[model samples]
Target chain A: MAIQREHELHSRRRGRNVAMGLILGGLVAMIFAVSIVKLSQSQSEDSTAPNYVPATAGASE
Target chain B: MADVSSIDTREYEAQFGDYVELLKPRVMRLVVFTALVGMLVAPVPVHPVIAFASILCIAIGAGASGALNMWWDRDIDAIMKRTMGRPIPSGRVQPGEALAIGLALSGLSVMLLAVFANLAAAGWLAFTIFFYVVVYSIGLKRRTPQNIVIGGAAGAFPPLLGWVVATGSISVEPVLLVALILIWTPPHFWALALWRNEDYKAAGIPMLPVARGERVTRRYIFGYTLLLIPVALAPSFTQIGGIAYFAVSLVLNVVLLAGAWRLLKRQESDRDADNFRAEKQFFGFTIVYLFVHFVMLLVEATLRAFDLSITALPIWF
Candidate 1:
């Protein structure tokens, strides 16, 4: 009975660890995705459309 | 302290599993699910990482409350046949150990949420844990016939906490969500209490059915079910829910009210011969009732987000 209980305990702990690991892994992946989305939006704005034109270009003048 | 050399390491390690069991994972699932829905339907979007961490914290806080409840109620748990197999009651874990783990996890979850989310959400989470452990479990549970009626607030906080995590502010919509849970709780729990009256009696706990008699309890259940209908429908009038949710809530509430009526009309013989099948079915449907409401709200939110909502009622309506 003691040995059986020990085995069950070990199994439960292993299951817990696996579940926790999956949750942590998913959180990391989501954060990475959000970062990519934010970065691309910033990059698109900076590269495609400048907020200001150069004085020499005379667009503003 | 006992000698380290004399301690049995293998037995000590096995006890760790029992500590997890004390957290009441089944209850934690509901806490997480409802909290997730709360986050999903909030007016402002939460960052994915913050949402994930906050929900995790909410679940941990819920588990912490469960552990603390178990720590406090080990004696009664041992007496009740339904709870006799719990970790502390079964001797798989010690009372002091449960208390320590509960306190530790309570602080950890609160601190983690404060760091990952806003202080308001974390503070609400802390209050929820305290309410469950101190106000409900220790104070009122064994003392009053209205224990579940008052104690149910602790169970209903996850959605409000989730909403706060997302928006850092309260609104009538989330307050209505909390109100829906508050009204729905009595009938949901009373149905279980109807069948489990024996367990409460054996444990010397003052549950409604045991204290006020089944007839009165059934009447209250029917009364609360009737009250829940208007509250559940009110959200659709607000911006939180739309046509799909309105239809769903109407149907679910009707079914649950029918069940409550049946439970109220059940003969004593029906309760005895069939073992309160009406009560049990009402309990089962109540779970479905609550879950489906949130799921429909989530669906409405998702649809509105994509500007594909065909089921949104006119704002004036």
Candidate 2:
């Protein structure tokens, strides 16, 4: 009975540790995905050549 | 069904499968599918990797809502024949454990969605969870006859949330998609309610057929079905849908309308063991109806994405 109780305690501790690891891993993945999206968005914005229509080009005289 | 008093968590140890059961995988599949349609139909291109991550977050959020719903409804669940085997009610998992998992997954899903997609998408996901878990499951469920009508919004919001995640904004297209689901839910659920009236009555849950008579519920089923036809067709006229979608919608809605008509024409006295075939058939068809329309939308979007002009509507349209 004592050995059984010890085994249960060991399993519970392992489960807690695994849960903590998953949470930490998810946080890291979230940060990484956010960084990639932000970076890609900024790069796209920068790459797009702005249309600079001359102010007077279409003005009627 | 075990009496709530007789449920003793100490008798059963939680298994890995119990946690999966808490997610309500069947409902999650529909949620994920609709959300995927929302994402795919958006005008802006989403990177496949980013899209995958966003969808995963949405799925997790939906699972969280299911867990929370099970937690909140565990008592009524214990009494109902249909829900007797759910994790909490079956005594496989403790209520405290379910609640903790629900809350944990809820926060994680929301934050992950916000980071991977836009905050608007995350906000909508958070609201969807809150609406399902709190507003529908807890607040309106036991109190009103119109519970399913309002509660339906929680399920409808996923596609719109998906659209917002992809585009980082809301638009008429997504709103129309949400509207379609919103209108469709009543007839869908009410049909099930008609079939499962005894379970609901036994649980003292005020479903339409329980609160109102089956006759009233049947009338509502037809009325909502009539209302749904127009909403289902609305998307075809918009920028999102084209000739292919219009043709699909026309055929599907007419069949759906006919199904409703059959239900309406059937007498309430016909709800005997041999004759709920109409109800069962309508309930089954409604699921197909929603899925087909959304899949057609995805087809239209894909056609447009590839510049496949053959399926495109005429220039005048």
Per-residue lDDT over A1-61 for candidate 1, one digit per residue giving the tens place of the 0 to 100 score: 1333344445646755776677679757755754554343322224345433233231100
Q: How accurate locally, in lDDT, is each candidate?
A: 0.83, 0.84
Q: Write the per-residue lDDT of candidate 2 for residues B1-317, one digit (tens) a residue.
A: 43333444354557566887898989889988999999888877777767778888888899999999999999999999999999998888889899999999999999978877878899999999999999999999999989999889999998998898888888888999999999999999999999899999999989999998888998999899889998898887777788888888899889888988888878867757457998999999999999999999898888888898364454322
| Best by the DockQ measure | 2
Q: In candidate 2, which residue ranges exceed 4 Å CA deviation?
A: A1-6, A9-61, B1-11, B310-317
Name the candidate that leads on TM-score: 2
Q: Worst lDDT window (10 residues) for model 2 chain B?
A: B1-10
Q: lDDT (0-100) at residue B297 of candidate 1?
A: 86
* Residue pairs whose backbone atoms clash in candidate 2: none
Per-candidate DockQ vs. reference: 0.06, 0.11
